[model samples]
Target: GAGVSQTPSNKVTEKGKYVELRCDPISGHTALYWYRQSLGQGPEFLIYFQGTGAADDSGLPNDRFFAVRPEGSVSTLKIQRTERGDSAVYLCASSPGLGLSGANVLTFGAGSRLTVL
Candidate 1:
């Protein structure tokens, strides 16, 4: 896809289960980010990957959340021991690196809705 693409638009899982959400960013984009949005709340950054390495991951709530961009293009967000409170819409975004003016605009996907029962 020309834009960011996320798979399994919706997912329903039982508590204590694990889930993996996949994202494919636009070709040539070197910056990718993962975020989660709960009901009535804005999306919160989970991690940001520059190329094949994570540039920032301080937003991850805890060890239960993790993300990887192995090839610097496709990325995966992994959630372990899912809880009811963990249910939310996971969002993926990508940018073509910072502009000369230091502006970095992102293009976001439709998001992957996760529901824990």
Candidate 2:
């Protein structure tokens, strides 16, 4: 099966600009998640989708960040009014959708590195 993947492995943008990052999850995986990792820090949960619905989105920092998983497969993270603080690595992961019953081991994509100027 194809593993999760992300594009633009690196992104450089000016402050206040908008950017959209994409993620493609593994085949047959129904649970997807997004997380942000700053330098020297662990990945922070951003949003997660179980099927077509977002099961948890509490980690979204602010209105500047948003995500969507329309078909319960591929997903995208959109950022608006980019700021230097927004610079970080955006990672996407997916699991077997069994929630607590499953191993919950998330297979992460390489991640998209965002740098705000």
Candidate 3:
């Protein structure tokens, strides 16, 4: 992919259902991040992966939320037992992960809009 790409631009589900959001990052980018944006707030970090391994996942609210980057290029965010409170736009971003510039330069996807009813 030339840029970060997220699937299911809009997803609406009832509470207690399971949901999965996918992200396809730019080719060769080794750093990927998952974020959540509520109705009126900036994006909040949920996880960061330096490669196939997750370097940080502290921002996840609980056990119900999980993400994985198998080949280091594509990622998936899984949410179990979804709740209305979980409604938000899930953002995916990727960077080069080469040096200091890697930490600052990010290409963001349009984001997956999750709406729990």
- State every prediction's TM-score relative to the real structure: 0.94, 0.95, 0.95
Best-to-worst order by lDDT is: 3, 2, 1
Better of 2 and 3 by lDDT: 3
Candidate 3 TM-score, true structure as reference:
0.95
Off by over 4 Å in 2: none
> Cα lDDT of all candidates, in order?
0.93, 0.94, 0.94
Error of 3 at 61 (Å): 0.5
lDDT tens digits by residue: candidate 1, 1-117: 788999989999999999999999989989999999999999999999999999999999999999999998999999999999999999999998845545678999999999999
Q: Provide the lowest-lDDT 10-residue window in model 3.
A: 95-104
Name model 1 segments beyond 4 Å from true: 98-103
Question: With candidate 3 superimposed using the best TM-score fit, by how many Å does residue 22's alpha carbon deviate from the native?
Answer: 0.2
Q: Per-residue error at 62 for model 1, in Å?
A: 0.6
Clashes of 1: 0
Clashing pairs for model 3 are none
Which structure is stronger by lDDT: 1 or 3?
Answer: 3
Candidate 2 residue-wise lDDT, 1-117, digit = tens: 488999879999999999999999999899999999999999999999999899999999999999999998999999999999999999999998846764778899999999999
Quote model 2's TM-score.
Answer: 0.95
Which one wins on lDDT? 3
